[model samples]
Target chain A: MKEIVVISGKGGTGKTSITASLAYLGGKDIVLADCDVDAADMHLLMQPDFGQAKDFYSGLIAEIRQDDCIQCGKCADICRFDAIPVIDGKYIVDPLSCEGCGYCPRVCPTDAIDMLDMNVGKWYVSTIKTGTTMVHAKLGIGADNSGKLVAHVKNEAKRIAEEEDKEIVLVDGSPGVGCPVVSSLSGAKFVVLVTEPTVSGLHDLKRVYELVDKFNIPAGCIINKADLNPQVSAEIESFLKQENIGHIASLPYDENFTAAMTQGKTIVEYDENNLNEILTQSWAKIKQIA
Target chain B: MKIAIASGKGGTGKTTLSTNLAAYLAEKQEVVLVDLDVEEPNSGLFIKAELLREEEKYKMIPQWNPDTCILCGNCQEVCNFHAVLKLGEQIMVFPELCHSCYACSELCPTNSLPMVPQKMGELKHFNSGTLSFIESRLEIGQEQAVPLIRQTNKYVEECFSEQVIKLFDSPPGTSCPVIEATKDADFIILVTEPTPFGLHDLTLAVETMRELKKNFGVVINRHGIGNDEVEKYCSAENIPLLARIPNDRQIAELYSRGELLYKKIPGVKEQLDLLIHHIEGLESAGER
Candidate 1:
């Protein structure tokens, strides 16, 4: 299967909106994966029928047995994190504060502390309105293994693609060039960077592009809300040319996108008779690389 | 009082506000601004701070005494993060994956684990006239940021005391690092845009602050651009909107060229001076 990832240098760049539209057009033929675990919102549009989520453990959380507890404060003292907090003359472990480093339980003089398995987060395989399978997940508050979660989603999407023999896989990537993004791009066919027409957008575009180029992934750029700043849009076009990243099309500033989101619909379905044409064209370009 | 300038989104002026707010308060007080956005620390770029000190921060990795031990696998079994593994009488520790949780040493059957320090990031100190700043830089590809942030904060706590005001440029979002930075602050200044995504993330940030029970106020950056979603949310939630920084390119342009907003706009400092006084008043009133 050929996979295409939709990413933006920054949030609110319409990356998820565009990716949902593509999934709609590819209905049943594409397995969708969302790599934006930190603040995933694609589900609001996709409406995946989440099923059978399993725990994904990544970070360490310290466990202290209370019976052996000596109030020596050794763990709290050594905890560079102050994760082991002392309150009301009693020592307690704050999971949110705890980095799960096993240090506190190890240094406990009473041997009362022991590390226990924790449910860091959950991942789901679901069906969206597009008749495509969606692989998504939610990272628990203070959970540290987002990269692993991204990998889980991608692996599930690939598995479904092979099982269904789908010709295309669409993945929605998050806003930063961090570990999660790196996991999303590993072994991806091509990347479509959705960006806005602003200085921050351009800077983010450069950062994400560097990541795409580092992996030698063939890529293209799609500017969302391009009419917001014509000058910046032109600057983006030139930057893409210099970097040889294809400038796909600049989507105009449209209230239809927000309206569609509020109505719990993808832009294509929300304005199928008109806006679908541009979305379809974008899909065609993505197919070329596929 | 130490206050942290934070936001739910990146480029929402965390660095800009932190640097300028640092300078704004530096004139009257011994202020230190610690930029804890280690991923992309940019506070120093705007301030003409003179370098004072730099130190690398590290996490402890357990060194194994294989000769004194049998591969009990207890370390692997107790490890929730998979940072430890035992195979065929061989126990291996992955330092990069380790959160320095010392569990292996604590649970070792033969007591074969010893904590050995491993470098993870660096902390830099600088002074911009009266304002001193500290920044933490996590090594690229290093996944652990909470430890470094906690280390950075601890360093600041130990190194300085009674700065009339202290500011922390926190990382975006309401996650571990963000929580670690703003926990002990006297006030939290949340800078946010007014877009849908902006409002959405801002809600999450506010929820975190409320959950942590910290007193906070809002600073609406890029004001008058998106909508009133943030205003509505803040008003309904009883959160205060401390200030509304208008949408201005002069600020963005100066930011791109590495300049603080207070430096570009003189009166902005005066306004922040009043804001600082307000915070001081609140602290005193709170004590009452």
Candidate 2:
């Protein structure tokens, strides 16, 4: 199956809006994957019927046994993160500050510290309006290992696509060149970078392009809000040409997108129908290139 | 006092609010704007700042010497990030995955591994008219940003003065990076729009703020463009409503061109002024 991951290095660049439209137009044999675990918003538009979520276990966390604590303060002194705290006459381990390095356990003479697996987040498989299996996740507030969560969601999407005999996996990637974005692009067949026409957009476009380039993935650029600044859009076009990345589409600055989103719909599903033609054309081009 | 402008969702005007608020606040007080979004720091692009200093941040990673090694594989076992690997007789080390916990070198039986400083990112200091700015730029392909963020905040804390009002432009999302950036802040400004996505992510951010036990307020950008769900949610949660930036094509265009709208947009300066007073009120109330 072909995998097309939609990414924007900067947030709020219409990655979800465009991805939802594409999934709506792509019709059958498509599995939608929302890999923006840190801020998964695709479900807001698709309004999927979510299934039971499974807990996601990531790195270990240190927990000190209260009964065996000797309050010698050796673990506190050696911890680089200062996770171990002497509180009220007993030593305690702060789960938020612990990095699961397996260091504090070694330094503890009383063997009180035990490294335990942490449930960092949860992933779900659901059905969207287009009858496509949508795989998404929610990373717990203040939790780490978003990259691993993205990987887990993608793997689930791939498994469902295989079982259902789906032909394509449409992925909605997260913002920034961080671990989660990297995981979304891992082993993907193609990448469509959705960016805006601003200095931050241009800079983010370059950074995410470099990240996709590192994985040697075939990628294309789709500039959203193209008319906001023609100069920056032109610069973005030239940059894509220099890098030989395909210029897939340039969507106009349309308020219809916001209107559609506010009504819990994609551009294709909205009653206004202003953004339908451009969105269909973009999906056609994406399918042809991807 | 340290105030952080943050949002669970991206593109909610954290940078816009921060840069403009800092510039306006500098007119009456000594202000410092620290952009903690090191992965994609764009605050530096909007502000015209004079270069004051730049320094490279580094972390210690174990460097294994093959000559002194017996290939015991103890270092490989102790590493949590899988930065070290043991082949038949060779050891492979991946520096990018290292967390600099020094567990590998400390656990090495033969003392073959030694800790060495490796470049992680850069911290920059700048003077933008009356405002002092600090930003961290992580090297491309780098995985972790918390260390660089910690180092930048360390510098800010060391030189902190009683007269300066510090504003932090935090990264999007309620993950570890956002937690690290806002941990020490006196107040947090959660920026959001009025859409469903905005409300969804704003709920997550509120959970984070409550977990941190930090006082916070909400700023609604692109108001009148979407539904009233966000305002309703804020009222239900009792989060103070600070300001509302109108949804106007003119404002979007101004933002696109990187113009400081506080200077030209009608009533924007006054709204920001009111926001400053609201924050001060919150602080004074907290003290009482």
Candidate 3:
């Protein structure tokens, strides 16, 4: 199956909204994957039924047994992360700060520390309202290893697509050029970079495009709020031409995006006029190229 | 006071508020603005400053030495990040996966796996009068942001004093980078819009801040766009609603042009003043 991942280097550039609209347009032929495990929100619009779930265990966390009568401060001394702190005269492990290096347990004289597999998040394989399977996940609050969870979600989506003989896998990637975004791009056939016509938008687009270029993946661009700044829009068009990235569409700034989001609907489902036409055409262009 | 402006969702005016707030506060006193959003830092776009200093940052990773003949797999066995691997007769180190925990190097019996610094990113210090703007960006394809963020925080602590007001433009999402950016702040301002996506991510950010036991408040941007659920949720949860930046096209236009809005727009200046007043009240109340 051919995979097409949508990403935005900067946040809140309507990446999820556009991805959801594309999924709706794809209907049952596409298997969807929400790889934005840090802030997975496509499920908010996809309305996936939580029928299949699995615990996602990644890395290890140090747990101290309090009954062992020893507070030698050895574990706290050796930790690079300030995960272990003396709280109320007892050494406590802050899971959020722990890197799980497995050194503290070895240095503990009392053997009070144990490295245990951490259940960092949960992944779900469910059918959405559009009669297509979606592979999504929710990372634990303040948890690390989001890249692993994203990889798991993408692999599951690709596996299901191949098994069901689906033609495409549509992935909604995360913001930023970090681990999660990198993990989501592995083995992807094409990339759709959604951005805006703001200074930050143009700045971040170059950074994320550099990453996509490093992976040697063909990419397309869509300026979501192209009319927000005409000058910046012109600059972005020139950058797209110079970089050889396909300029698929330039969507006008519209309140229907937020209006549809507040009503738990995609713009395609909410508006049947200009936005619908633009998004439909955008999807067609993506299909033609990707 | 060190205050961090963060949002669980991106493009929620974290950079907008941070840059303008720093500019406003710098008018009277020395202020430090650190953009901890290393992955895609945009605060530097709005700040017009003279380049003061720049330095490349590095993180320690294991470098395998083939001269040691033991061929023991202890380095690979103890590493938690899978950055080191012992394949047949050779050992490889992947710096991107390394967390710099010193587990592999310290545990190596033959000292074959020695820790060495590898360039990860660069930090640049810019000065515009009383405002010191620091921006650190991770090299592209670098898998982790926490190490660079930690280094940037160290640089700030070494250069700036505690008496000056410090504002951190934290990265979006409730993950390691976000936690590292806000963990040491005196207070945090969670910026959010008024939509479903905003509320969902804001709730996640709130849970994260509470987990870290941070003193924080909320600011609503694009105030008139969607329903009042964000305000309602903050009230129900007793989260102090600090300020509301209205949905003004003028502000958007100014921000799109990479201009500080508070200087040009009266409404933005009013919100910044109210936010400063609230912060001063927090300081007097010892919330700082």
C-alpha DockQ of every model: 0.20, 0.80, 0.83
> In model 2, which regions exceed 4 Å deviation?
A271-274, B285-288
DockQ (0 to 1) for model 1: 0.20
TM-scores of the candidates are 0.80, 0.98, 0.98
- In order of lDDT, best first, we have 3, 2, 1
Backbone Cα, N, C clashes tallied per candidate: 11, 0, 0
Q: Any runs in candidate 1 off by more than 4 Å, and if so which? A: A6-28, A44-81, A101-133, A175-179, A192-283, B27-30, B62-78, B86-91, B105-117, B248-259, B262-278, B286-288
lDDT of 2 by residue, B1-288 (tens): 889999999998999999999998888878999999989998988888899999999877888899999998998898888999998889988987888887888778888989999888899899967799998988878888888888899999887685578999999998888998998899999999999889999999999999999899999999988899999998998999999988888888888878788999866787798899997886687678
Model 2, residue B194: distance off in Å is 0.5
- Model 1, residue B133: displacement in angstroms? 2.9
Q: Give the range of the ten consecutive residues with the poorest summed lDDT in model 1 chain A.
A: A98-107
Each candidate: chain B TM-score: 0.93, 0.96, 0.98
What local distance difference test score does each model get? Answer: 0.77, 0.89, 0.93
Tell me the docking grade of candidate 3: high
Candidate 3 regions exceeding 4 Å error are: none
In model 3 chain B, where is the ten-residue run with the lowest total lDDT?
B279-288
**CA RMSD, predictions in order:** 4.6, 1.3, 1.4
